[model samples]
Target: MSTRLQSTNIPSIHVVIPGIESLKTSLESISHDTKFEHEKDMMFFRQRGKILIDAMFDYHPIHLMALFLNPRTRKMKQCTNSQRQSCLEYIKQEMIMFDAFDSDTQS
Candidate 1:
């Protein structure tokens, strides 16, 4: 995932949102099982997952916007309905602002 994220040709924002989502899903699956073979391994994954999930919260809106703008990722199926709606609202707001600016300049 990190290697793919670092690729020069790919848009990093496009990869980041989905990549983190995939990772979060995997982590949730791992944590779902009650039994753990190794306590240390469980602890390590829990801490790392917590950190990653928390970090994601801080940047989720920006990542969602990037995903929405990308042709391939525009559907953003991985995101929740509320999140998708939020992104749409933000884009609409930006478009309104741009239109206002354009009209003012024309005048």
Candidate 2:
């Protein structure tokens, strides 16, 4: 009788967040395998990125914003009705520049 031993190599992916809790949370959210096929999961990450972008604009935290907006993170999806309304209010309050641009262009 002959015996064979098999070995498998798994590559590691690192996402570095500033705090340990955040790092742990991020790790918990993702899979080790690259094949994350769920469309809803992908959309969630994208929405998260948009939220981070908005936070950055409000707080002026460029690095955190950049990390969130990274293409590797994910593409954003349409927000739910409540989230959309909240975001609209936030934009009106904090993103007057964008609103002004829209208004000027429409005239």
Candidate 3:
């Protein structure tokens, strides 16, 4: 997944959102009850999941805007209308700022 993200030709954001989803799936798989596992180990993994998710969001909120634009993720049943709108609004404001900077540079 990291390799795909580093590729110059690929849609990097597409790989990113799903990569997290895959992580969540993997976390579930790893933390599930098994005959060989102890209860304390399961508790530790559960705690890790929260920390991981918090860190992911703390990295940057805007980089995640790319996820809202893509149709595949936009129309997902899991994606709410409000989430899309909020991210879109912030992204639009950012684009406007970039355009203003570009105009200043050109002039």
Candidate 4:
């Protein structure tokens, strides 16, 4: 991860968002794991999974914006229409602030 960050000219939000979604999906799919020999261990695993999933959902706006900005993911094929709209609005707001900052700098 450090190597990739150093290699990129800018922060790679586009790449990070997809990788996060992939991990979240994988954890969501884990209904059962026979490798766990005891119920307590299984419970612990599920609890941790739930925490991670909640964290991912909490930061979903960041993920959504990254997806919307990425050319390859701009279509947001995996997202609902409402989510796409939310991202669009977020971007518009950011751009407005940026424009204002640019104008201020010119003075």
Scored by lDDT, the top model is 1
Q: Which sections of candidate 4 miss by over 4 Å?
A: 1-10, 30-44, 60-63, 78-80, 100-107
Candidate 3 has which clashing residue pairs, if any?
none
Evaluated at residue 44, the lDDT of candidate 3 is: 82
lDDT values for all models: 0.80, 0.43, 0.66, 0.71
**Tens digits of per-residue lDDT for model 4 on 1-107?**
44543566776765555565565566556446576668566667766986877666554577788878778878887677887898888889989999999999998
Q: By TM-score, how accurate is candidate 1?
A: 0.74
- Which is superior by lDDT, 1 or 4? 1
How well does candidate 2 match the true structure in TM-score terms? 0.22
> Residue 52 CA error for candidate 1 (Å)?
4.7
TM-scores, all models, native as reference: 0.74, 0.22, 0.55, 0.57
User: RMSD of each candidate?
Assistant: 3.2, 17.1, 4.1, 4.3
Candidate 3 regions exceeding 4 Å error are 28-34, 59-61, 76-82, 94-107
Tell me which residue pairs clash in candidate 4: none
* Best of the two (1, 2) by lDDT: 1
Instruction: Put down candidate 1 lDDT per residue, 79-107, tens digits, no spaces.
Output: 88988999889889889999999999999
Clashes of 4: 0
Error of 2 at 70 (Å): 1.3
Clashes of 3: 0
